[model samples]
Target: MKTAIKICGISTLEALDAAIEARADFIGLVFFPPSPRHVDGHAASALAMRAADRIGRVGLFVDADDALIAEGIKAGRLEALQLHGEETPARVAQVKERFQLPVWKAVSVATSEDVTRAESYRDAADLILFDAKTPKDAALPGGMGLSFDWSLLDGWKGRPGWGLAGGLRVDNVAEAIVRTAAPLVDTSSGVESAPGVKDAGLISQFCRVARAA
Candidate 1:
């Protein structure tokens, strides 16, 4: 099967266009205020309109409230919700129930134990995103360009569905795909010229490499 690609932290129309041109499966719009890639409701609406049935839009959120999630869903016309914070299984289910959208719970992987922990969300989330863990004091949960050991996922058979993220670039995404056999791959800082700045050339190249793998 072909590995799906998601270009995340897309805040500008240029970045959104790049993802669409690259034929990426999804583009992430961050709603967390602390992240450099965070976009307001109006900005997200414009970007969503520009995307308009061409590609899927996933909204990234921290431990946000229902009101904020509602605003993001309305603004971005999100197809899915990616939870990237310390949310419990119940909360995940609650969000999924409230939004009535496919919910993806991002599990921070630092060890095999962390990988096993993803099972808690198997029933609650529509997908489990395995991402590298960040420091407890760090301002951002992901998009730091930090990767965990891919070997930890060797022969991993956890359900409902899953994907790989963190530190994936054009040069290394092929290796990541081979190692994990992930059905989907996501990247943010790896395809950026600077923090929160998505590079169009890099986006295209990353998609090409990931598909070729």
Candidate 2:
């Protein structure tokens, strides 16, 4: 199977085009205001409309309220909602039912214990996204562009429907796949010219390399 690639924190038409042109499986939009990549609901919705149907559109949010989720739905043709915050399983169910959309819960993985967290949402979420654990005082929950130990995934067999996220770049994504054997990888900062600024060339390269891998 081909490895899935997600170009996240997308805020511009150019970046969205790059993701679409590269045939990325998922194109993520940051809805949290604190994020440099944050996009207004209208703007996000506009960008989503321009993407090719082959690329999935994802809305990224922390432990946000229903209003935020409501606005997100209005903002785009979202295929999935990525809960990147401390949301409870109940909340996941609520969001899924209310929006009638698939849900992907992002679990922070640092130790073996963190991996077990996915089981909690097994019934509630459509998929799981393993992201790096943020420090206590971290500004935003994700998009820090940091990587955790890939070896931690050496024997992972917990979920077939999860995505590997955190600090992935074109150069290392192939190795990450070889090590973790992850069928899906998500990246934001790693493919950017700067924070929240995606480079079209890198987007193309990442998709090509991951597809070939």
Candidate 3:
């Protein structure tokens, strides 16, 4: 099977089109207010419309409330919701039931124990995203370009749908796939020339390498 690639934190038409033209499996739109990648509801809706279902459009949210999600849903036709906060299994189930959409729980993996915890989300979430844990003092939860030990995924299997994230770039993405056999790989800051600024060339190269891998 072909490895799925997600070019995340897209905030511009050029970046969105770049990911689409590069055959990205998913395009992420961040909704968090604190991050530089954050996009408002109106902009998100416009971007999502631009995608036009050619690629999956995922909405990234921190610990958001129902009102905020409702606004985002109204603005952006999100195909999936990525919970990137300290949401519990019950919360995941609640969001899935409430929105009747696929929910992806972002698990911060630092050790084998972190990987083990993903099992609890097997039944709750549609997809499990394994990301590197951020510092407690850090303002943002992810997109710091920090990576964990890919070898930690060896001999570990949890839910049916899963993806790899955190510090993934074109140069090392192939090695990551080879080591973990990850079906899906997500990158935010990897293809960016600056924070929230995506480089089309890098996006194309990342997609090429991931597909070839």
Per-prediction backbone clash count: 0, 1, 0
**Between the candidate structures 1 and 3, which one is better when assessed by lDDT?**
1
lDDT per residue as tens, model 3, 37-144: 999987998898898979998889999998888787777788899999999999999999999889999999899899988888999999999999998899999999
Tell me the tens digit of each residue's lDDT in model 2 across 66-123: 8888888777778889999999999999999999999999988888778876778888
Superposing all C-alpha atoms, what RMSD in Å does each candidate have to the true structure?
0.7, 1.4, 0.9
Range of the 10 consecutive residues with the lowest summed lDDT in candidate 3: 151-160
For model 3, the stretches where C-alpha displacement exceeds 4 angstroms are none
Show model 1 residue runs off by greater than 4 Å: none
Ranking by TM-score: 1, 3, 2
CA shift at 200, candidate 1, in angstroms?
A: 0.4
> lDDT of each structure?
0.95, 0.86, 0.92
What's the ranking of the predictions by lDDT, best on top?
1, 3, 2
lDDT of 2 at 182: 84
TM-score of each: 0.99, 0.95, 0.98
Best candidate (score: TM-score) = 1
Minimal lDDT window, size 10, model 2? 151-160
Query: Compared with the true structure, what per-residue lDDT tens digits does model 1 show for residues 131-196?
Result: 999988888999999999999887578588899998999999999999889999999999999999
